[model samples]
Target: MLGHEERYDVLKRSLAREARGFTLIELAITLTVMTVLILMVVPSFTGWLNNSKVRSVAEALQNGLRAAQAEAIRRSHQTAFVLTSATPAPNTVASTSGSGSNWYIQVLPVYVGETLDPNPMVQSGSFGNLAPNVKVTASPATASLVCFNSMGRLVANSDATTSTNFGTTCTAPTGNITYDVTLTGATHPLRVLVGLGGQVRMCDTTRVLSTSAPDGCP
Candidate 1:
């Protein structure tokens, strides 16, 4: 019911209100809140990312050890699980690195001159390519090489020729052989435990192994 001039004035006021979205103080407060929230989330996100990398590396190593054990049982012969920094190949004689990121499995000859398959490599896997920053360390340090007998149980191998250039020898573990996988920013480092019976499992290193805490490790 207003006149043209009054209608135009009302329209102008409405437009002005619409255009005045956020004040400078409001914008500054909003930006400060958002920055605080982001700061709170970044550390948690980074920790989660690092922990995921540790777990991924641990699981890969656990699966490789299990595959080696299964191969030994299936072939009804001795097999070697060697952790090395070198590239793995059927014809390659790789050495062991205690903190290696790659793993190689092969059927081992019973004796020095025994003739078996020319290419004894069963499987090869890598954790380095997946999580380069993650560190893998064996507990005994000398347990970079593990051997499994026909019965899928840990065994000792005195043969220096099993793995070349590293003087790696497979010795039966007195107890569980553990490989700790960790990252610098990770909150939950993981451990891949290889039992003397060739059982392989992954668990959190931050907790104790218990009925209530299945993800824990000793």
Candidate 2:
């Protein structure tokens, strides 16, 4: 029962009320929602980022190794792939053993009637240095050097006893030199597996890449 002028005044008041900014309670509720959304999204994003970085590193390593192998075969020359770590605190083989930290592989051209060096000193141009933050601690293997002949065939690694304890170094098959990777803070840590055929494969602990049963690495 309002006149046109009275209706106009009422509508003006409603417009002013509607134009008011959010209240503290509304702001608090909105902030809570936004925080919840962020909390839910951040972990997934972080995991994805970490996983991508790990995969990239693994691929880079695998490609470098495979290329080195291929280059050796194509040119029929001695080629070596050196792995180094950023910080080496002298991982000891045993308390009494001396200088058990650095390790590497040397590709020696085998000649008839010539003796290949059985134990080449790591520092005697046997293995090269590793990349930044990349460390070759150890694995399940009998030797440190896995060599490939000029035909890209894995040289049958020497017969020796290797340590299987955690952080113990192991050599890849003589045919193809491969290495695995472990990322620091990834949600689903990725493992890189290299084949004697110089093919790089990847899988998580939860899944299998190869059709064959579980093994340390192919």
Candidate 3:
């Protein structure tokens, strides 16, 4: 029903409304809300990222150890899981007890003279350097070499033929015994337990250590 002049006025008002943008105060409020939301989320995200990195390293080591055990059983040969050190001491046995970023599960042939084969099988292989901020810590009494016998039994430095360079820290306990390898992050630590029965288990250190928590370390 509008005439030409009236239609022109209505179009101008519509365009003017369409051209309007958020005011300075509205933009400031929106920015403030977004900043607060980001601040609240960033810390939790950082913590989750750090925990994930540590867990990844722990799980990798666990899988490597299990694979080594399986290989020893299948091939009926000895396989060793050795911790790689950055600065290995001369004429001293390798000790997994110290902190390091890398480790290996090496499959070697049977012992001949005074030592097992120096070369490891290519199939078993070595596994990596942990996350930048993560670290590995083994039990104070941990042996550098964890080996499996022909029957897939866990043995640590039991053979006299092994090179003295492999540190002699652990003596097989009379009963069921376990050694711990821990992966530590900024907030939590995870433990990989290797038992004399050739069992490897991953445990969460952050979980409550009670019967109520089924996942608590044994």
Best by lDDT: 1
Give the C-alpha lDDT of model 2.
0.46
Residue 181, model 2: Cα distance from true site in angstroms: 1.7
Residues forming the 10-long window of minimal summed lDDT in candidate 2: 92-101
lDDT tens digits by residue: candidate 3, 43-143: 88877877777778777777877877887888777776666654343333444534555555555535435344444532332335443356666554444
Q: How are the candidates ranked when ordered by lDDT, highest leading?
A: 1, 3, 2
Candidate 2 residue-wise lDDT, 98-171, digit = tens: 11223333434344233434532122121223223333322323323344556664444322123211132224
Go through the candidates in order and give the C-alpha RMSD of each one to the true structure: 2.1, 8.9, 4.2
Error of 1 at 8 (Å): 4.7
lDDT of each: 0.85, 0.46, 0.61
What ranking of all candidate models by TM-score puts the best one first?
Answer: 1, 3, 2
Superposition error at 82 for model 2 (Å): 1.5
Candidate 3: where are CA atoms >4 Å away?
86-97, 108-118, 123-132, 160-170, 173-186, 208-212
Query: C-alpha displacement of 188 in model 3, angstroms?
Result: 3.8
State the number of backbone clashes in model 1.
0
Candidate 2, superposed: residue stretches over 4 Å from native: 1-15, 86-138, 141-145, 156-178, 197-199, 210-218
Task: Output the number of the TM-score-best candidate.
Answer: 1
- lDDT tens digits by residue: candidate 1, 118-177: 788879999866556899999798779888999888898777454432366777688999
Q: How does candidate 3 score on lDDT?
A: 0.61
